[model samples]
Target: MSGQATVLVVDDEIRSLESLKRVLSEEFEVICAKDAGEARRVLESEIVHAILCDQRMQHETGVDFLKHVREVWPDPVRMIISGYSDSEDIIAGINEAGIYQYIAKPWHPDKLLDSVRGAVQLFRLQKETETAGIDMKLTPERVKRVVTEKRGAAQQLFDFDRIVHAPDSPLRDVIELGRRAADFDISVLITGESGTGKELLARAIHYGSSRSAKAFVVENCGALPDELLESELFGCKKGAFTGAYQDRIGLFEVADGGTIFLDEIGETSPAFQVKLLRVLQESEIRPLGAQRVRKVDVRVVAATNRDLEAEVRAGRFRRDLYYRLAAFPLHMPALRERPMDIPLIARRVLDEVSKAYGRAVHGIAPDALSRMQCYDWPGNVRELQNEIQRMVVLADNGQLEDRDLSPRIRSSGAPITLRNGHGNGHHNGHGNGHSVGATLKTQIEALERLMITEALDRHGGNISRVAGELGLSRVGLRNKLGRYDLRKGVSRDG
Candidate 1:
């Protein structure tokens, strides 16, 4: 048998404690504690590497004891277990006790053993960091290395420079805002369509932030059930609920000294929103079944496709949480609104997809690019990426031709005139399905409407600024607005 580290297991029930001891005894030295008091006594004497404490006890809760442990004897990797999935207790343990993992009741022996072994490894790494003169319990460099290694080449490519955009692209302003926000430790909310690279911007913000060297964990609130999502974000203890067989480390804990990107924050239920509000307000988390909350220094960067202000007014979202998340807000413009960026982004995607698929694709044809720029990209950047990859995979010649693009893009509308070196490719001059060319007047009005809408979205519905940018008098702009039926398009508050 290997000379393994000592593990302290605390539980009020003798049967369960004995079962845990039996499962772990062969691998390591097992110390048993019947209650928090007993656990305290064991901890005082033993040089244990990890502690597995029960959340529910007669005298002291697991989180309460662990919080005390964090103060006096903080070296051991702390974990909690409980029968109930109480979110308040769970959040408390995360914020106060600094639990390593929260395991639910009726844990599988193998998984529990694996968790203890992992905790031992964490304890060793932490000790090494301390011995190497690092003051923090968790080494930022070490954590960064692990995250980078796990994420591989993809994460490395998400830095600020990778956010490709043309010089006049509206995304440039958003990117600049994000970079500036990264310098400060503040909550940032990125609002955009699903495929508009909100997560990409979030990653860039994280990597550019002061906390870049620590973990940058991500959680999708919309992807999981409320109970599961709560447990995932805050963590759950053993016996916290059925199927919670092992202690789990939450994204909040993993990103304690770094950032936690919460995607689709608007999709979370109102009840879950309240819990999230508590965390943002207190800057702490309580693991499921925990007795006290644990403090965390994690910066939050939330992203959503929904209009949270609308949600808040509809009573579907909590106002306080919305305000907390949007302390700094960044919006990504849609792909259709930034047509000039399409060619550049498409070329970038082509290069990436070519390498990924081992294709010998050179670049995109001008005609194809012109076609792409004409189509209104409802799916935004994500759709474009998929289209580019599809073209790369099917390209017969060195370059992707017009025929290589999807039928949706090819059959959409008349190709826009390319500003760069691309030649003027004329469509049948039909508007939307009309084989007849659009009258010169119809064409001008369409172009005018497009420009006005872009300005409104960019300037947050500032009519005066829109008029100035379009080189029109306020009355002229107002006349155009009336002609185009655009008066209701922007709110007066902007």
Candidate 2:
């Protein structure tokens, strides 16, 4: 927790190494070495925030040694110092070591100090990010779905019909899960916050499944009154009710040989739920004033923002209907969780809005993206799409910045912690104090951990790629990761 940083300098020449120690000792805990072997021994003693090493060492190269550090350490940034004019090998080493930046021979004290300082700061931030990951109860897959979706269908939000997304996005997963439900002719309950695209997902599933060729219909259970809802879902014969002019086909009959989406299913009254249960139980819709029951092959997909389980436990929704309708369940991740996909979402939403407005805008700027990423999109992707639409029309140019975002979603405050429980900040245990710096440090460590683990996972634990993506020296990334005791399978986002 000390502001003081410890830096290790490795070089073959004793005089030059001493010179660096003298220059750096004023602001840091300087550990000097004449070779990589001695440097290794010192590294074993205590955590070194940054490493300043010469390109050429006795019998070993600095780049090669730093590569070792990248694998073993994952935080401390690596900087290579060289007197030689030829930087070809040094350049190659830069990519390999994940070296932060290079210091040419005859370096300035200010430059050297600045470089080392930046590296240390980056190290602290990255380490803080890594350490913060332990409290994230959300798994990697969930995290990816929450913050890092890649559905091609979703990328084009121009029209609901042509939603393209990569398989990785939750949109596709939801569709796939719903499609599977369609094939079995079982009921499906889709639950998520408002504007979470539950109905859209249902449509996608219905159209993609085995019942694609059949009629697919939708009815909002909450939009109509109890009597209207009942009549809408089940047909009525002529003179069945005061308003009945002739025999009417309800959604079930209309959706015969296909699927019916019951949006806001939880909004239905208990009596209505009982009526639904009967339909499920008997597979027949009893039209009012009809002599006989009519059988239907309509598949049902129900959606609601409310927790039907708790509702059933309460006196509200019926337990029988809840059990029957929830033959398959799928929960959509909120947008606050998946900030990584903001850029993609924003770009796509802008394009759709542009087409609608009959204007073409290229893209969003970095500043706008900064705000987008920082905001805790409580309403999820739906909210983001709306904001982008407002910005597209409101802003004069394509360079939408902080002001372009809706006032509520405007990024002015600190990043909101959607993560429930534990200390929102300050990993000094939990719920003690919300020390901004401490919590920020903790958050950075969590990010560091996630990035390191992801890089490692993608690279099959190869130190090179992990370091490269993390902007750490191979040695630094490995070092930080080792300090945290993360090895084997990673626990990033998870």
RMSD of each: 15.9, 34.3
Tell me the tens digit of each residue's lDDT in model 2 across 19-120.
999999888878888888888766544446689989988788989889887776544678899988566766777678887787898999999888887776
Question: Which lDDT tens digits does candidate 1 get at residues 60-92?
Answer: 899999999888777778989888899998999
What is the clash tally of candidate 1?
30
TM-score of each: 0.62, 0.52
lDDT of 2: 0.67
Model 1 lowest lDDT segment of ten: 416-425
State in Å the error of residue 275, model 1.
Answer: 0.5
The C-alpha stretches of model 1 lying farther than 4 A from their native spots are 1-156, 416-494
In model 2, which runs have C-alpha deviations exceeding 4 angstroms?
A: 1-176, 411-494
lDDT for residue 337 in candidate 1, whole number 0-100: 79
Alpha-carbon shift of residue 89 in model 2 (angstroms): 96
